[model samples]
Target: MILAAIWACWTSAALGQAVPNHADPSAREILPNPVPVPAIRFLTSADFPPFNFRDETGALVGFNIDLARRICEEVDVPCTVQAWPWEQAADALADNQGDALIAGLALSPENGERFDFSSIYLALPGRFVTQADAARGFDPSALTGARISVRRGSAHEEFLQRYLAHATLAPMDDEIAALEAVKAGEADAYFGDAMRASFWLNDNLACCSFAGEAYFRPELFGKGLAIAVPAGHDTVRHAIDWALVRLKEGGSLDELYLRWFPVGFY
Candidate 1:
């Protein structure tokens, strides 16, 4: 549980900086070579756009798709990435139809019992957005009685209640409603998933901009995204993890992140 909680708190460096690798620097200088395999079958869902979704040409394309190919290249193995219905991807993996599942599966206890996981490749962070004018000197720590809009019953709301109890909460029905509250001046700020906020910001919502550093509370938000293999498939899991570290170190992972998330959530 602590590993899960600590992994959740892995935040990226400041904006414009290189993407944080998220691997421990104190980790062994020499990593174990992955057991060789004939080919890797990567299974993903077509629903999660920007991560694993079909493009306009009906071609399977997204960050996960690209990453899977890169992993195969790094490991010197042939690979196939196939998209399935979100509801059935896990079953497909369980039935040995795929070597790995690259969908955005959370590293939960229930999931852990069913599959082996690679190192986290991506983690969602909480962020604050406020009116453009008010964003300049915003201080999340100084908000006493300030109204912050968050989705009702979301982990974000729980974060506010635990660490920013001095601030008044205006819980909304959903992420959009929470953001709308800030744009409409009903709340001083909106605190929620940074990735979602990036899309809204890039959508020409000039009324508000990101403020303050991103918050990474895995305990509240759930452990970040990782590739999953069958429960006993250590070889495939190790290969994925090894390739991920190589990708991060070589800047390929950062490139993919910037390509997909142009607004820079972190």
Candidate 2:
């Protein structure tokens, strides 16, 4: 992890100078670019909603979608977003199926071995979702045997495991399904991030409450959302990072964050 961090830092320093799309070689060239930022096939999980999800039109939409487009625009590359089931999107990408993955993923130790990660785009702490009666009162112990549902492969899955030792985990394919488990009474509680939980609950599960204070798992949740790439693909990672920097500089991210996570939405 230290090696990756240091590597990322070095790459960032070098990319402080703008890299023109026409100046770089393609991923298949004899002299490989460290990152695969140009004209690439990007992978994502549509079920993550508000971050990356399929709209009613069956077109992919949400924060990651917006962010990825901005990335491609910044690099002058056209991209294809293939929305797959959330459960195995990362594994599918790791097997060399796509150029990148950007589904609001938290940095994990396991991910470091197989993929390079971009700098955090957003800081998202995990929160609990429950009946207004349970969550309004903010009791973690009340979660015991509470058929707790969380999206599989999300950071919350690992967070709840180490932290909610007394609770029973009910894994779901996506956040919408997990929250549905709670709304349907099959699960007493669910775990997710505040910004996303608000959007999901309002649009999918209307009755669940945004409960307790948000929790952090420095060991598991890490700092923010990142784009994942093949390990040692530093050139692609650097280009993506530069794109994120552009969004921050251009105020696009600020507008989106304010719109999506308005104060007290949680």
Please give each candidate's TM-score: 0.90, 0.57
Question: Can you give the lDDT of residue 168 in candidate 1?
Answer: 95
lDDT of 1 by residue, 152-196 (tens): 999999999998989999998999988988888999999999888
lDDT at position 52, candidate 1: 87
Against the correct fold, how does model 2 do in TM-score? 0.57
Where model 2 places Cα greater than 4 Å from the true spot, the runs are 1-37, 126-192, 200-217, 220-222, 262-266
**What is the model-wide C-alpha lDDT for candidate 2?**
0.68
Model 2 residue pairs with clashes = 34-235, 35-235, 35-236, 36-236
Best model per TM-score = 1
Candidate 1 deviant stretches above 4 angstroms = 1-18, 24-35
Superposed Cα deviation of residue 85, candidate 1 (Å): 0.5
Global lDDT of model 1 = 0.82
Clashing pairs in 1: none
